[model samples]
Target: MNVHTAARIVPLHENDPRSQDPVLEELVDFVGYRPNALLTMARKPGVVPALLKLLGVTLRGDGLLTEPLRFLVAAEAARGARCRYTTTHLVHAAHHLGIGWDKLAALPSYLDDPRYTGQERKALAIATAGGTLPVREPAQAIGQARQVFTEEEVVEIVSCVAMVGWFNRWNGLMGSVLEPVPSEALAHVPWLKNLEV
Candidate 1:
């Protein structure tokens, strides 16, 4: 799982511009804007499609995890594991989803944070703890999540956490370097300066 550093990395070309779809365009934009190890891995034959499919399943599914929460889980997993590159990428993505860096910074103390709702606290707690703790007592926490999300949504939360864990391990092991998010976007997230990761 070595991180590819080819100067001219190749990725899938967009389909005909006349047939340009909004979803496809957005995906392309995301990849173009954030060229990371994941995107580099995706450029390999037979891997990009599978990665896209997984993303589709997560985004199009009827899961309880909101877009913000999904991004947060990825950010937290990267942060908790000290995966600097992944953490910064996820934090930037979370910011794009309108999740403030302050809120993300306070995630570790979510249980006592007044800014987070009961359901949000539960989801954050589950993601943060589940990453490190083997035995997760999610019954009560899941119950709280149920108040705001469907069973499918609960599954999404768990899946997002798992996805983050997987990527964090991969990125950390690979020693990926942190790429600065565009300065304009970074400026909007003042709290990012305070993030230790």
Candidate 2:
């Protein structure tokens, strides 16, 4: 039998009851294959399904944050969490949104980059501060966000960050293999590389 490529436990095969979820199918259609992360998370019974529901709402449902901004927020949060797995997936997502490699490459220096506009810079700052593990001094970044965005938009920014926070921790701790779709799409994003422990 082939070994589990990611996760502490084995992932479910296509015929597994838990793997038959519609949400999982949608994910497969979007990415061109079942992501191993979701497949492994499916092994737990409810996690992948529940997460997909939340993902549809937070990442897809109407929100004060623009669609493009949401991607940036998630990517920035993934970057802050240092979860290369999640960041790699976000790279694929960004491409679908018409956000380019160079634009994403600017993420490491987003705060001062000319590529990012004033509002994007504001959102990125909040993502960095809110996404910090120890939850550093977020007052300044959030306070700045409030000045430019509505309270709802600020919540959207923070919520998007919080949502990806799960993936950041889950994929990081599980050592989730970078799925083929994202692995091929990785380009040459240097900072997304996880350091060898």
Candidate 3:
């Protein structure tokens, strides 16, 4: 189950001063540890701070979507990309927010699952569109999402998906290693079916 790639890049170890940069500390605070993705992104100048800022704005939008629901949307996007890397983080954040492992394991059936509301379903659908791409009907996805969400709210949902899209592509290609806190905390990997890249 070693999912790493042959051309894997090493993340900055905690002892590396670059890993201790103030902006990088924000990621430490957010994830409760220095994330491997952030540590790797830190190798480039200014990417960490700017990306973290984008994360804050996207995840902490104008109070339209609840924080837990935001994590829910992210889970769908992670499934779309078949990224165990990002989904592991979502499970970590979800647990911190009091969302349970049972709920995470049930995500594949969200469309008919009683756990999600119509609005949440729309947002999840839109998120998957972005993550999986060339989504047969782009306009249809946006239209469906707009039905249950305001223009601003739709933008918020899109922001969540787009933000994760970065990680989906970067981590998938870089073969970024998953941190134990989230990766191991996740009880099961049912969101995507044999689709982790």
Candidate 4:
């Protein structure tokens, strides 16, 4: 077995009871495999539904934040929390949303890349701040975000990051394993190398 498999606190298999859950089944269908982070959360089955509901609101609900920006916030939050697992998943998700591969590959240098629009950079900065603990949201960052977005959009961005922040803590504490699907998809991403630690 791989060393990363040691993080499995509960069995999560095709035959596992939770794997049969409609929601879990939907997720499996979407990703082409069961994500190990969700499996860790599956240890307490009740948590899955609640988290999914939260995901529905933050990820799929009507909001001023665009889908791509929300994915960026999620990825940035995962990056801030240092969870390669979640970051990999978010990057895969970004690809599915039709974001350019070059931009995804250049993620490590997002702050310097001319490809990112002014709003994207500001949103990313907010995601970075929201991801960190001690909640270090700088005045300047928030000000920049406010300039680029409305108060409602700013709230949406922060809310999106906060959702990912919870998953970061949950998965990190569980030592959640990185499943093959996401691991394979993100294998070539240069920025992901920095998160191996």
Candidate 5:
């Protein structure tokens, strides 16, 4: 699907007095900057905090998935959803975590890449299945994934994909503009050329 050319809703600019919701500060601290999507969602007083809190649980809480693995899951889902904004953010985050550039650049072809562990490939496949529209995750894929990942780890993997699902839809619908940080960070990768927007 093509990215929307215009936002369905108007976004709040950082300098706008109306954008001064206190929760935006929390997001800034979380991400090192106020992403355009979060600032836009800050239009609703409650959403920013609630989303961040959920993100904390999904990303930072005790779980079988490592932070790097979680980032891969998120990126896979974002790419499947064709969401450049979300894809760029997660891929940029992966780079910061010291995951190899070639591994990241090879994400679309994970099945053949030796760099990705079997567990990582399973999670990526699940993420790919989950990210498609009409939301069809194959039973075989989930079952196979379960063999390698614990039931809790499967939940964590699905949770990571599910989280990006929200951002992918939100940013896709919002036509959210990309910020410079992730935009710049994603520049060196070839497969991520879609993120150049």
Candidate 6:
């Protein structure tokens, strides 16, 4: 695994609590909670600014899924690809949303795990199979997802996975560092230490 520390860069726009609209504040908090090493790297070259702008538009417009669900989809994609940096970030994102480490770890096993609800199981199966299989296989997974999610929601979920997969590939290829999870969060989620590729 790569051990280089990621250098933090300033956000293009100030994250002042007073200056932010309610929705923007929520988005900022969500981003702040996750250690996105890839975004940090991208910011150094001005890529993050453009990406954030696009994300802002998407979030404000057609992103039909909730923030936590989008994060979950990305987490599944990152885990399946074994991209440590992306996985670590997504894990932290899940933690921020009150998801337990055991639940996060069991994501890969959700299809067969009795603990998952039918909808949760279906989403996980779709995410897992979509990550591991080609686009064609994801058609079946998408069909399953449609049973639980609206067409727009399913598209957002699939888009989240695809975006995470792209970031995971880049992080792996660039040998990005895995930032440690926050100490407070780590204390509550010991299973994170045992996470496997």
Error of 5 at 100 (Å): 2.3
Q: Give the Å shift of residue 109 in candidate 2.
A: 0.5
Highest TM-score: which candidate?
A: 2
lDDT of 4: 0.75
Q: Candidates' TM-scores?
A: 0.69, 0.90, 0.89, 0.89, 0.87, 0.69
What is candidate 2's lDDT per residue for 131-151, written digit by digit as tens? 767877789899988889999
Per-residue lDDT of 88-148 in model 6, one digit per residue for the tens? 6776777677677677667767777765678766665566766644544777787887888
Q: Per-residue lDDT tens digits of candidate 3, residues 1-197?
A: 34554427888778887766776676577668778887888788788888878877877434688877888788778878788787778767876777777767777887898877788788888877777876646677899988878999888888888888888888888877777677665546454335574
Best by lDDT: 5
lDDT of every model, 2 decimals:
0.59, 0.77, 0.76, 0.75, 0.79, 0.59
What lDDT score goes with residue 12 in model 5?
83
**TM-score of the candidate numbered 1?**
0.69
lDDT-wise, the better of 4 and 6 is 4
What global local distance difference test value does model 6 have?
0.59
Pairs in clash, predicted candidate 2: none
Q: In candidate 3, which residue ranges exceed 4 Å CA deviation?
A: 5-7
Q: Which segments of candidate 5 are over 4 A away from where they belong?
A: 1-8, 15-27, 195-197
RMSD of every prediction? 5.6, 3.4, 2.2, 2.5, 2.6, 5.3
lDDT of 1: 0.59
Estimate, for each residue in 1-197, the C-alpha lDDT of model 4 and write its tens digit: 12355673754665777655677676666668877777767777688878877886886546777787788778877887777777888878777666776887776567999988888998888888777887775677789999979988888888888899777777667777777777754555767756742
Candidate 5 has a TM-score of 0.87
Better-scoring candidate (TM-score), 3 or 6: 3
